[model samples]
Target: MLSSYLTLAAILFCIGLYGTLAKRNAIIVLLSLELMLNAVNLNLIAFSKYGAIPSLTGQLFSIFTITVAAAEAAIAVAILIALFRARGTVLVDAFNRMRR
Candidate 1:
């Protein structure tokens, strides 16, 4: 069961990686990042439940990760909005070629 959980998490993370790499839209990339983060949280929580620890360290770490992820998302969204305003498109290639 633990193995299965870990496998699922790995699959989710991989899917997120592909999404992040294959998508050109800023919002889609952001969503993929969130998906990857959730995969990590799942692994942490699962380890916390199954592993022999004096305290719920994995759970605590997962909480910390979640907090950090929220901050990252906020910053990323702001940057995306700025990019959209300046470049008129969120596609990675468009942003890359942008110049005066």
Candidate 2:
């Protein structure tokens, strides 16, 4: 069962990695990052449940990660919105120039 959870997390992480690397849109990239964070949380919970000396450490860490992820997503979205307003586009490639 632990192995299964790990496998699922790994698959999710891979999908998220692919999305982050291959997607052209900033919004997709942010979503992919969130997916990856979720994978980490899944792994943490699985380990905490299956470990010999089970404790609340893994869950606590996961909560911390979730909070950080939420804050990061908020900031990233704000920046994306600002960029879209200034540049009229949200494609990652369009951000390369860095100059109006």
Best model per lDDT? 2
| Range of the 10 consecutive residues with the lowest summed lDDT in candidate 2 | 91-100
Question: What value does the lDDT take at residue 98 in candidate 2?
Answer: 52
Clashing pairs in 2: none
Work out how many backbone clashes candidate 1 has. 0
Each prediction's whole-model lDDT (CA):
0.90, 0.96
In candidate 2, which residue ranges exceed 4 Å CA deviation? 98-100
lDDT of 1 by residue, 58-84 (tens): 889999999999999999999999988
After the best TM-score superposition of candidate 1, give how far the Cα of residue 3 lies from its true spot, in angstroms.
Answer: 0.8
Which model scores highest in TM-score?
Answer: 2
Decoy 1 TM-score against native: 0.92
Model 2 residue 47 CA deviation (Å) reads 0.5
Summarize candidate 2's per-residue lDDT along 1-100 as a digit string, tens digits: 9999999999999999999999999999999999999999999999999977788999999999999999999999999999999999999989977576
Lowest-lDDT window of 10 residues in candidate 1? Answer: 91-100
TM-score of 2: 0.94
